[model samples]
Target chain A: MTKRVAIIASNGGLFDAYKVFNIATAAAATDQEVDIFFTFEGLNLIHKEANKQLPMPEGKEHFADGFAKANVPSISELAAIAQEMGVKFIGCQMTMDVMGLEKEDFVDGIEVGGAVTFLEFAKDADVTLTF
Target chain B: MENLKANVILDAKGLACPMPIVKTKKAMNSLEAGQVLEVQATDKGSKADMKAWAESTGHHYLGTIEEGEVLKHYLRKSSKDEASEKKHPNVINNEELEKKMEANENIVIIDVREAAEYAFNHIPNALSIPLGELKERINELNKQVETFVVCRTGNRSDLAAQKLAAHGFANVINVVPGMSGWIGKTTGINK
Candidate 1:
């Protein structure tokens, strides 16, 4: 049976990045339906400019550098991979306005919205979360 | 009778934290503010996750309904009055930021690695809290200043970021690569 899941996000921290893909990928792997909602800081992660700038963590800079050195995809790239594999992307309108980003600022594939819009999405979700 | 309009439903299943949010953001943008957006997902953490997103981002959560095994979410766009009030999305790149806290400031660094790995070496002023324990001890974090998360690599730290972001931590940073890339001298481990 298909399960509905909703994820709410506002932070673009490295750990959060991991969570973003981990949860989405796992859900896909498990054959459940998933929906992701990006808001506040979380919107930055989906923005083309900010997403590209995700840095090497304090302690793990080497690993990231090594991956970059090896030409392996960065975390964002991996995220794209997951998206291609089947994760939907959404951007919060209020967040976009405060950041001064337009639909153009985001990557090629993303949806934008406001609170009531997201609530409608969340209302029927079997699982929902705010990240 | 209520008017019914077609909404673009995006299936974000088999994905993780930021991806869900990312996809939702995209779908909402493609839609008219007053239209409905239905998202189907399977992440166990989606319940409260969507609610908070709805509240902070200006979406009206119509409510949720469980059908068989799958759950469905219903949300509506804000009226023009509510739509004008915009908010910002805070995205912090661990590798991109250089944070320095003042002495006695409230800053916590979480090493989301195995105890053995953390015991070997970690950054100064960092706490060893594996990612597995994060959910249970999330309240330990201070929402005020800065809370940095790290792992052997960047993978786990991203997980930490998702949990902390969802839990409403205002200032959080996820260090890329985690301890594996720490260039400075390590504070000797518990060993």
Candidate 2:
């Protein structure tokens, strides 16, 4: 049976940024239908400028430096990979409005939507997860 | 990490959950049984996913070596066997087996999951002959033993049960829905 995976990206810290990208890319690799909905703090994940700089939740440069040393792909890079793997990226409209962001603020190909749109995808998803 | 050799080296760095597992599965399919694959990943989730996936698919989850943020996972192919369309007979639920265990039954439980999976978590006392190794290790199982084979989701176990039957074992039964569905008592080495 073909597996459908839906992920809700509601966090956008360094760790969470990596987590959502990793999972979305991985699920896409499985040839499963995969979608990610950006909401609340997760909205930062789709914002082009914000995603480029993943703020360290801990007050330290070591986290970002550590990622560099380990050759970990940046969240933007991982997002690109996830997109290439056919994973759909959706930016939450309500959050976008609340945050005073425009469509251009998000990465290219991010489909703007609200909770109802994501719920439709989630309803049929065999596996619905959150990050 | 430096000395590890593999037929395929999957660079899943920065990739999460299903992606690392997904890429590993694809890499594994390209190889013959017993060939090794090394996966390097950055996402922490890949640690558990790789271990669980390798066991689910019957590949040897040799273990992971971490270098800073990077996780290097090694897997050796167990066998070339794939899940067959043909059904294996007499599938039983976890409840029935739990009852059997409670009743002090003589049934022999063969865990067809990878050694990592068996080690991580499984029914207590289940034998570890991964599905990949099942063809060669069939002799290790007593022919007269009442066999119960299991995997994570029952896919590999189904294949193992059928394989045992083809090899002249008559008392093999596959555990339906596998260990993932089992709610009774369980144990493992990892926890």
Candidate 3:
């Protein structure tokens, strides 16, 4: 059975980016349709400006560094990879306004909307994740 | 039955972040303003990224519906085209981007890795702008220069370059292999 997975991102740190990318990628690999909604702080993940400066975790050489050092795609790269593999990326509209960012702050290829928009999509999802 | 005109069927199945949007943007770009691009995908993170992408970029979200595992994204292109009127090439490869950087005398290099990674080792003259702080500090850099953004490998930088280009930073570039491919001298992070 095909399952629909929705991941909610609220963290923008490297660890957060790593986790979000990994989970989303895994879902795509399993042939499950995936949708990621970045909200609040999570919006930072997609914020073209903010996403660049996320902090690396302290004393941890987990996924983020390993991915970078090993030449594996980083979260953003994985985002594109996931897309290539079949994943959807969305940014919360309400969050964008709340954060006082204009449309120019995001990357070129993204869709932006609010909770109403997200819930409309999430309502039918088989798996919804809030990370 | 769902009205085909109202339904947005975006094929982001084989693409990621900017690609989904890049595909959608292209679909929307060719259309008359106000036309909607419906996107479908399996990347769970796209759920939010799509909406945010729309909002900031002046697009409208009609809705998202799940058909089996695929989530359908409905987006409407905004009528406003004043700031984003110019059409940019949709797809850019690494070699093409590299040649441009090599030719440019004032390319701004950005490193999205942590300060430690940067301290431990980084490309020479690369600006250390961790992803988390990129937004707040992006303006600090001069947009007029050809900006080259990179992460540990190439993912974050790819996204960063796309983000910069999307925001009208016309001369931005993404470095593939990032610091991982730095053939020059290396630095170490002291803890």
Q: Of the candidates shown, which would achieve the greatest TM-score relative to the real structure?
A: 2
Per-residue CA lDDT of candidate 2, range A1-131, in tens? 56789999999887888888877776666557899999999988878889887778787766666766655677787888788778898999998899899889888888999999999999999989998
Q: Candidate 2 docking: what grade?
A: incorrect
Q: How many Å off is the CA of B23 in candidate 3? A: 20
Instruction: Give lDDT tens digits, candidate 1, residues B92-116.
Output: 4444433443334456778876443
Candidate 2: tens digits of C-alpha lDDT, residues B1-191: 12344567889886545556767876877987656678898878777877776655556676677788898787877754444353886798888888988887566999987665565568888888877778888778887778888886677888899898888887988888778788987876433
Report how far off residue B59 is in candidate 1 (Å): 37
* Model 1, runs deviating above 4 Å: A56-73, B1-191
Q: What is the iRMSD in Å for candidate 3?
A: 11.1
Candidate 2 accuracy as TM-score: 0.52
> How well is each residue in A41-102 modelled by candidate 1, as lDDT tens digits?
78767777787776555777667655444333356775676677566777888878887889
How many clashes in candidate 1? 115
- Which rank order by DockQ, best down to worst? 2, 1, 3
lDDT of 3 at A71: 40
Better of 2 and 3 by TM-score: 2
